[model samples]
Target: MEKNYFNLLQLPVVLPIDGSLLSLHYQQLQRQFHPDNYATAPDNEKAAILQQSASINAAYQTLKDPIKAAEYRLSLEGININEEQQTIHDSPFLMEQFMLREQLDDLEHAQNWDELTLFYDEMIERKNQIYAQLLEYINQSHWLMAKQQLYKLRYYAKLIEQIELLQEKQFNL
Candidate 1:
């Protein structure tokens, strides 16, 4: 299963890249090895099909998400960025996130739409900067660094969600 993930990551990791190619590949592979396809076969063959199907699903999931795709690549290089194993190497990013959260809390209490707009824009810019860093890490094959960038990207995405909620409140009022 792990080997299959490595193979899938080797393919382009974009959602729209070569449309229908991945789906076609997955379908062909599944048809040949899906557990149901081996229902009439021996027990050993059925077991093998189950194992292969599991691998296929795992590969499909990893290739579907850019962040996961990056992590899988890192894993191939002996780097594991699982949540429990991840280190906090980016203190500045953490500190910034803390400050942003504080400001968001204050804005929520004050109902300051204008300040929220400015903060949202700043956070969006920060997200773009992090994406640029992520690209650099990918280009350099710095999987660990890219994993850190992924953390920052997730944080920014969450912040965007919060900003959207604030905007909705503003619109409602």
Candidate 2:
């Protein structure tokens, strides 16, 4: 059986998890599973410890990130969100995405600090709103709606990454 990340991390398997608490739990697990402590053990024991350590690390990584946590949660409910096969049929969202991308392209050329900051803020707001809806849908057991929100959230995340890269370039140059 696939390991339940929430259970492994001692989390409640809920959205909007406490990041600091998660980090605390992760640190405790790391200390418990650190390989150096088992160096004097037999080879088979060492191998098993290593596997347990790896599983702990994987669970931490997955549960630490909101998107990954949501994906894992959905998978647990048997709703596999296949990015390649799943199509977001919301036309308005698609149109908004195109417009946002167009704006981003123009911002790339213009390199206006104020505009870039505004766009970044806008993306953040959109991401927050989507996350709110995602939480609502998930709470209500609206799996499909939550899945669609997750897809939209991914796009906003990419936009945020691009904006941050642009900001980094500006800072360096």
Candidate 3:
């Protein structure tokens, strides 16, 4: 049986989880189950400790990021979010994405920090709005709506990363 990351991490299985508490639990688990502590154990026990350590690391990583945590939550509800196969057919949403991408492309070529900063702020606001919607959907068990919002969140996240990378490159130059 697959492990439920929330249960493993002693989390509440909710979106917008308490990140600080998650980290604390992860650290405590690591200290307790780290294979280094079992150095003198029998071979079978060492192997089991290794597996437990690996599971703790995996659970920590999955819960540390909101996107991954949300995806895991959906999976727990028997709803798989397959970005590759899911086609976002909402016309308004598609149009907004096209417009945002166009703006980002223009900003990338221009490399104007002022404009890029403004764009980044706008993207963050939009992403936050989507996140709020996603939170509500998840709380209400509106799985399909939450999935759709997650798709949009992925786009904004990538776009934000692009802006940050551009900023970093400019800083280096």
**TM of each candidate vs. truth:** 0.71, 0.95, 0.95
lDDT of 3 by residue, 1-173 (tens): 86688988888887788989999999999999988899999999999989988998998898898888888888898888975688765889889988988988898788778999999999999989988898899999999988988888888898889888888987898
Specify the highest-lDDT model's number.
2
Per-residue CA lDDT of candidate 1, range 60-157, in tens? 77666655665666666677767686556788878988988999999988999999999899998988888778768877877778778877887898
Once fitted onto the true fold, the runs of candidate 1 whose alpha carbons sit more than 4 angstroms away are 6-20, 83-85, 110-125, 161-173
The lowest-lDDT stretch of 10 consecutive residues in candidate 1 is: 10-19
Between prediction 1 and prediction 3, the one with superior TM-score is: 3
Candidate 1 vs candidate 2, lDDT winner: 2
Worst 10 residues of 3 by lDDT: 82-91
